[model samples]
Target: MTEPAAYLPVLQTGRWFAHLPPDFAQPLLAMAHLRQLAPGEVLFLRGDAPCGLYAVVRGAINISGTGGRADEARAAMLTRLEPPHWFGEISVFDNSARTHDAHAAEASTLLQIPHEPLQAWLTAHPQHWHALALLLTDKLRTAFVAIEELALLPAGQRLARRLVMMAEGYGQWTAEGQSRRVIGISQEQLSLMLAISRQTTNQILKDLEARALVRVHRGEVEILDLAALRATCY
Candidate 1:
C-alpha cells in the first residue's frame, strides 16, 4: 500500500485535506489518480456528468460558464484555483451534472479521486461523509459573501476585497510562507470575475498600486499590505 505520508506535506497546505482523519486521508491519497493538463485544455465542461473530486496540486484551474446567447456577457469567468483546493464535491453528493466549465488556465497537475472508488470507501466509513460536506459548505459561505459584495459594494471596494480573498485562497490558505502573497491572476481575468470592464480593472489596480497596497505585475498581483486591502472593502 502507498503511504499517505508521502503526499501529506503538499496536501496539508490545503485546510480541508489537513483536517481529514488519519483513516480518511490515508485511503483517499492512496486512491487518488493523477492527470496533467496543457495550458488552455478543458478539464470539464458545464452539464457534463460528474466524474469525481479533484485537488489542484499545481498551477491554476479556471472555473467558468458559457451561456448560448447573442450577448457577449453571456460568457463569464468565475474563479481561478491553485493548490491545494478541492472541488467537484457538490456533484458527488447530489449525483448531478457539473454546474460550470473547468479548464486549465495554465499547465496544471491534479489528483482525482474517482466516483466509484470514493463511493465504495464512503459506504464503509460513513462517518467521514461530514468531512466531505464541509468542503461544499466552505464554498457556499464564499458564494454568499460574494453575493452580498455584488449587491452592496462599489466596484473599487469589491475589487480590493477580491484581491484580499484571492490572496487568502478564499479561506483555504493554510500554508505558511510566501505562497499567500502572490495571486496569479491577470487584470482581464479579474474583470471577468467581477463582471467589470478591463479598463475599469486597470484603473482600480492602478489606484491600489498608488496607495502601495499592491504591486501589479504582468500576470500576477502581489499583496503589499493584505490588511489595507481588506480595509478598502469598506
Candidate 2:
C-alpha cells in the first residue's frame, strides 16, 4: 500500500491524534500504511484475532456485531464510522479477538498501523499507552451516552440524537469544519444503528420531514436545521 499523502489532515484534526506529543505522534504516522476495501468488504470479523489499528481516510466503515449474543440487524449493527474516526484499538490494547465486524460500507481507505510494531513502540514508551487509553475512554463515553439514550429515550428521540451524534462525528470531527449537511448513510444502515425496524425508521424520518426538520434523499438524510435536530434530541 502507498502512503496517503493527503490523508494526514483527517487524522491530525481529530482530538486524539492532534493532542499526542510529537515524539509519539510522528513515528506512528510514519508507520501507517493504507488498506483499501471495496464496498461490502469485510475488514475484520467477530472473533478474528487482533490485527492492528485503523483510521478512516476516505469512506465509511460499517461497524456491527453482538459478540455472539444476537444476529438480527437491530441487535447486531452498531454505528457507521466515517473519516477521521480511528478504530480497531480494543483488541490491540487487550490482545483479544475482535469483538465485532468492521465492513466497508462503501469503497473505503483506512490507515493501518500494525499491531507488532505498535506494541513494540508502546513498550519502549510506556507513558504513551495512556494516549491509547484516552482513545478507549473517548469511545466508552460515547457508548455510555448511547446506552443512556436507549434506556430513557423514545425511538424518535433516540434516532434524532443519533443523527446529531453522527453529524458531530461523536466528537471526532467537529474541529475539521467538515460539511455535514448531508449524512451519507442509507435507511437500512440508519435503522440498524438505532436498533429500529426500517418501516419505523422511514415513518419517523417522514415525520421529521413533515415537520421540516430534515430533507430525506436517496441513501442520505440532509439536515435542514442542525439546531432543530439537536433540539429534537432533548
Best by TM-score: 2
For model 2, the superposed segments whose C-alpha errors exceed 4 Å read 66-75, 174-179
State each candidate's clash count: 0, 0
How does each model score on TM-score?
A: 0.93, 0.93
lDDT of 2: 0.86
Candidate 1 local lDDT, 1-234, one digit each (tens): 433345567789888989889999988988888878999999999899988999988798999987765665476788998888999998889889999999998999888899889888999999999999999999999999999999999999999989888887887967653337888899989998998999999999999999999999999999999887888888
Clashing pairs in 1: none
lDDT of model number 1: 0.88
Give model 2's clash tally.
0
